[model samples]
Target: MFKVCGYTCNRNDFLKKHMRLHSGERHYKCEVCGYACNQKCDFKRHMRTHSGERRYMCKICGKEFTGSDQLMKHLRIHTEERPYTCKVCGKSFYQSAHLKQHIKMHSGERPYMCEVCGKAFKRSGILKTHMRIHTGERPYECDVCGKAFKRSGILKTHMRIHTGERQYKCDVCGKTFISSCYLKTHMRIHTGDIPYKCDVCGKAFISSGDLKAHIRIHTGERPYKCDVCGKAFTQNSTLKAHTRIHTRESPFTCEVCGCACKQRGTLKKLMRLHTRERLYKCEVCGYALNQSGDLIDDMKTHSEEGLFMCGVYGKTFKQSGNLKKHMRTHTRERPYMCGVCGKAFPKSCNLKTHMRIHTGERPYKCEVCGFACNQSGSLKKHMVLHKGERPFKCEVCGYACYQSDELTDHMRSHAKEKLCEVCGKEFKLKGNLKTHMRIHTGEKPYKCDVCGYKCNQNGTMKIHMRLHTGERPYKCEVCGEAFKQSGNLTEHTKTHTEERPYMCEVCGHAFRQSCNLKTHMRIHTGERPYNCEVCSKAFAESQTLKAHMRIHTGDGPNKSEVRGYACKQSSDIQGRNRTNVTFAMKHSNMIPGSNT
Candidate 1:
């Protein structure tokens, strides 16, 4: 207790400090800064400015405080130590003055009354700031912007724009804030400390301002009302955003491209394109994306929720975009047409890749080997071979693959029970069965324009045209090997592995491929597939018939036509009458293995 002007006090030290108001004494002083104060406590607090000493500490939060009052206030948050209680309402508070204010609320007491307007306020600080409105007093001014504010705090906050200073920092997330109040508000997100409670639904909030706004929902109070449309909103920001519709004001603009947008988020997303900023990332595959929409689109690829399924192959996709792209395989729909050759592709990206054929553009280049590809994905997959990196692993088996499609294709090998109903033949994929059915139906959909030769498969037709054009696209890196198609490269790699996967069922003979086994099976079946058009003689094999043709053409190794044994046997076989016995003799001057 302290006393002044003939009032009694408990301690002489307190009386000495209390007399400073009348005596105007400056007894205690700082040694380093030469600053003086009337009381010892004030001088000691000022000395801390030079000493950088924080004596008080909070035990629960491990936060150090320079003053005992600050430590006491912070302790209430953890301990909920409210000592002051209102007598009228029996409400507890952390501070005695807050309890006094609570008692005034029940009594409807406003002791601080304005002299001019007779209006009242509870707090002296509020009344002082409010009196500035009538007095037109803006004492605080900014040094940088020359802006006047009612209080020094507002002036300090405004100075942050020029100074770029953030004094308060979040301890949890390391994010800095310009003001202590904003930092306090942000701490609630990490602490989940809701101090303000709504009386309507018992919903809690971290701030009193938020609780007041939430109460408007229950009361149906629209304080911020629109003038033009006669619409009401609880928040001022919502009203301001809604007014943009009537005003047609696009405030957010891109600095890079001069594009304007209504929302700030849209402008921010557009700016990322010029900056090439990839903020949002995929967790599953570490794929980086610029916008949240792009992240959402990429996340669907990793999801197991197959909303769309292919009817022909039974392949599933998580997104509708992927399923739509896959449907083009069955429909053979090539909507994206090339401008150079008028060749159509199923996807726009595929068309972009096709345009590179004419442009001779291979943008994606390998860093290790300098192998360039038109698509970026091809370059990424090709790099894995150099590193021997197989990231995609099968869950059923321990098999690994370089790409996601390789993993999908490998899964079919584990589930090999799927069979073709037409031929009762087993196939790893349903698409293989559909392709095999083409052989039975003799559906030569693919036709060649040069020689009018038709094939059941499009891939076979591409290989067939390579015979005429002499085009070999696939090349091996280990060996100087080149092939007309990718399947040839695959088969050529097996030479290095020495893997014999195919076997004959009749005999225990093993081969490197199924096609070789099919050729060997013809020996047991005695199936003569090749026939000579000149004499209608069926041969057991194409190579044998080609060799025997030399005897009829007088181009045989014997050179005497082997006494024309080939043509005489062909004419006598099957009891068929020859159109001309001298037909073989007339064609003796003809060349062997010639198109003519």
Candidate 2:
């Protein structure tokens, strides 16, 4: 007898053939497939796959295989026999190869390791599948969609999507699934068996994948990152959903309103808006919500226990995420930033809400009035008008309001005033009085570093900085025109409609803007706020004051010709004025048909 590399052989020639496994020698090669093997018998089996030859057949299921051992394994399904059983877990399998793989899992022995990523696997076949991630080799292609996959088993499962073949059925719910593993996970809903649990958070999950994703919260590990925004997420699916913000891809569509969403879960929630089906319910308060996350948030209101505490202000929140957001308020951390507008926000939802102004997406709508709005909070406020519900009221004056914040603001009228010493201006809040003082002191602290533009308010500085950056984030949906400020977008939207709310009482003239009406009123009052410093001449408009100053500087119209300069040909001035007009029309949408 002869032995080589743990394989015993009866002859020396057989032992020499077995030695080729470790020696990295492949003598037998198939001409058609280029499949090389150490043994001639294994090489012959590889040829049978391309030849479409099945020599052995199973009588019970009418299935065929190229080898007798494969036929024998198929027969075990009809016999309902699992001869190979694991001693550790009592798990059984039909084939000895499967049992060997299962045993290695119990021993935590992963001998097969990928050379590229260093990922260990219990079986060599699994390691080969993992190698495709680095190699970019996808051999299995779908016939219908042409979508490629790395493994044959995954391709087989994907074929079920086209065929609609769901063989695995749950006995309890009668729900069907594509695979037995999915069915097993579904059965846990009925069994209430959450076997997988996070050791760090003590949160239980139905599957190991859910537990693995939950563990990332404690580890602060975000393996998946966005290529465009550099935003990291714990799950790959979450990163995929986030990438839609840059891509603007809305694959999932609603049937009723033709509304589109980037994710299927978002489409499902949008469908609930039309259906009005409250699927998630609170056990304590009997409050129902269409979204499960909203239900989870509502459930927190029922309990005061396990509240997260803020270190700075000592404020308590029901969720750790809310507590983390509260800490950012104290730290003045604005992590979520808009790539388009170059604006930073403390919360991601604030950034998302800000993005809708640029996107012109009015996702929320009033079902009663057919009115649509961008923000969900705006929709909720609009719904209050239709519902006519004044739940919040002042206790002292009986001043009722739709929102609690409005009632709180009304309560300030009853409180003592915060007086400004310089101007004798009485404000309801101390912060308002502080802002009022800046006007009297001529103090403009918020300044743009780019243009040295000064403003008393930080928000005005942010808007002014956009002028230097040439960023017009707000966009009109109808004309596809962009604007630097949201107030400019609001004024531009009025051009799309003939709804002029501002009117002159003296002249009976209507205007779309209150600022225009206020300027028109100055003509009737003969009030000239803009006064020329050179001649003490007054004008109703600031542009008139600027034109009057040009006369004193000898730069007025026809003044250069009077000074014997021949007006300087002014092609450069005309070109610069044209360029300025073009830029202003592009960013501020001053011209109506410029976008078209």
Candidate 3:
């Protein structure tokens, strides 16, 4: 029952000296190695190299260590005991340090900071790697590839190529990889498992990398920047390819096609197209694809039915890309801007077609309908409507579709074998299951064709592609309001209808969708997921988070209310409506009376 102050005052100040040991404030130095350490134990460990001391030994493995902590970590291999446990998920770790790192998974605490880039990391090891940017120190080099890395571990892994070492082998497929982590990821293909999932969208991924990319959809963290255009990327590979544009370095030269690609993977895929090699074939549908990604996109035609619906006509699409394009008819997210007329569009393909108006290029022509289009795909879809030919039919359900891709998508709803092991979510197609598994594992496969924009879904990539090509197809029927897609038209129609379906339970406020409602609910609930790294201030949304971050940079408050208050004059009438005298009087009287 002794007070902390009473006990601290009575102590002989030994604790202060002990704290200096933990802080690593050097009072001692080794003349031989020029190593200075604060603690006696650290000095003792450093002296081991000079003395050649092998006092701490393991009887089982005959391994020697200079420190007690190293010996304790090594003993875990023999005992196989994981004492440290995470409170959030009940995950166990062999080391206390590992357990502490695992705790950050719940708390999201990033303690380590890099002075060069001002990037924060949860682990000190990551921060050390980040410091290399400022120092320009790449210690690890691959002898085979002549590639350099900042870390020694990465160099060791790269050396595996020269050694032809396949140290890690998949137990299920017998596939070999240089690293255990890669093998662990490959194992998920056989198991059909995805452990990681997005809490916002319910999308699953097979790996943490995929999850990180998906999180960018919510946070919009484009870390990798391009020197040429000041454009940013989420992945390193994307940034590498983008740098090639400035350098004009196309290392990947095709032997057959003679086409040069910045990325080796893209070149490899292009080589397959030249060879006419349909390596990946669907077992259920007998559909063949040259690339695995194309096969995945093809499979989505079947599995993603009733999920991605058109906001315009309540029609569901198998692919989110189609649905997103369809949403342009409603939201009027005409991001693609033309340099000519200052007009914008939603889809790049549509923008390309629009460009034809200026250029007078009609590439696609209909034989029966006598309508010509800039794109063949549009003409094909248009021809189906004219001919009434529903050739593509589902074998299981006998549902006929005009397009073969649409039929393939419909057939997936009938399939029952594919299932994600992590979330237990069922999918009709294996490719969809693979993509869905990415939601759990957090693997992002789709990349932007223009800007190397990597995303979990092709829809996001398509939206990103619009930044390069200006395309707006959907035009308002009443006011000649041009839009990018049909969905924008529908959403624009809502402006006329004034129909708000989404309503907040707490405040009874109506909104267009559940997302808007949820965002509004945060106002009352005071729940903010987005936070500023500089000041550690929480924000309800990413926009708010960005505005809050600006404050740390000596920027003014970005909130509309705060800006309005700052701009307001003392004599000006302030209320809901300035013109409505009675309404202004009512609101003005209530403002001082209410706590808000």
Give residue 438's lDDT in candidate 2 (0 to 100): 90
Q: Write the per-residue lDDT of candidate 2 for residues 41-146, one digit (tens) a residue.
A: 8887788899999999888777889987788888889998999999998999999999999999879999999998788999988998899999999999999999
TM-score of each: 0.35, 0.57, 0.41
Residues 528-571 of candidate 1 have per-residue lDDT tens digits of 78988778788876777876676677553422232333233433
**lDDT winner, 1 or 2:** 2
Task: Give me the runs in candidate 1 sitting further than 4 Å from their true place.
Answer: 1-335, 345-348, 467-542, 545-596
lDDT of 3 at 190: 45
Candidate 2 is scored at a TM of 0.57
How many backbone clashes does every candidate have? Answer: 0, 0, 34
Worst 10 residues of 2 by lDDT: 559-568
lDDT of 3 at 380: 77
Error of 1 at 217 (Å): 40
lDDT of 3 by residue, 1-596 (tens): 12433324345555555556556678779999688977677888989978999788998999999988888888988999889988889998889999998888789899998876778999999898889888988977777678999988888888887798998987654658998888887676546477999998877778999888889878888998988799999887889998997898999899985667899889978987788877666655889877655655666666753357765688876667778888877887998887775678897866777888778778577777689888778897888888888888777778888887787777767665787799888877787777787777778889765667687877766666666777666777778887666666877877778889888887788987667788898899889888778777888888767655655675543223312332122233244224455444555655576434
Position 257, candidate 1: lDDT:
65
Task: Report the error of model 3 at residue 130, Å.
Answer: 6.8
Model 2, position 274, has a per-residue lDDT of 99
Candidate that beats the other on TM-score, 2 or 3, i.e. the better one:
2
